[model samples]
Target: MTETITRPLSTEEVSEATGIPAGTLRYMRHCGTGPRSYRLGRSVRYDTSDVAAWLAAQKAATARGGDAA
Candidate 1:
């Protein structure tokens, strides 16, 4: 049987994918207001699924006139 492996994304990659600046992503992480992430050896890693889920949550919040930050 064959299996697929998905690796986590770096801040730069996430910035490119979401159009959010890398610095902003870092700041968000510091403020605990960004997508879920984890530390992998001294680097922060973000799971693709978590990013998608976070984006969805932000969209929902915005639609409901809640703080989307």
Candidate 2:
């Protein structure tokens, strides 16, 4: 089986995919509360897998009888 390559997403792409506003996404980054991101020289990129993992973690946290606050 051939391995699939996942492309990194731009901030706008990530915001579109997650239904989050671009400004909110930028604020999250500034607050360091968003999914892990990387800086490529001057461009910012988010991994789809990282976003999915963050969602799973949020679900698990909520499932543990704790409020995300």
For each candidate in turn, give its C-alpha RMSD to the true structure in angstroms.
Answer: 5.3, 4.9
lDDT of 2 by residue, 29-64 (tens): 999988889997798999889989987887777776
Q: Highest TM-score: give the candidate number.
A: 1
In the predicted model 1, the residue pairs found to clash are none
Stretches of candidate 1 off by over 4 Å are 1-4, 64-69
Q: How far off is residue 59 in model 1, in Å?
A: 0.3
Per-model lDDT: 0.95, 0.87
TM-score of each: 0.83, 0.76
Best by lDDT: 1
Clashes of 2: 0
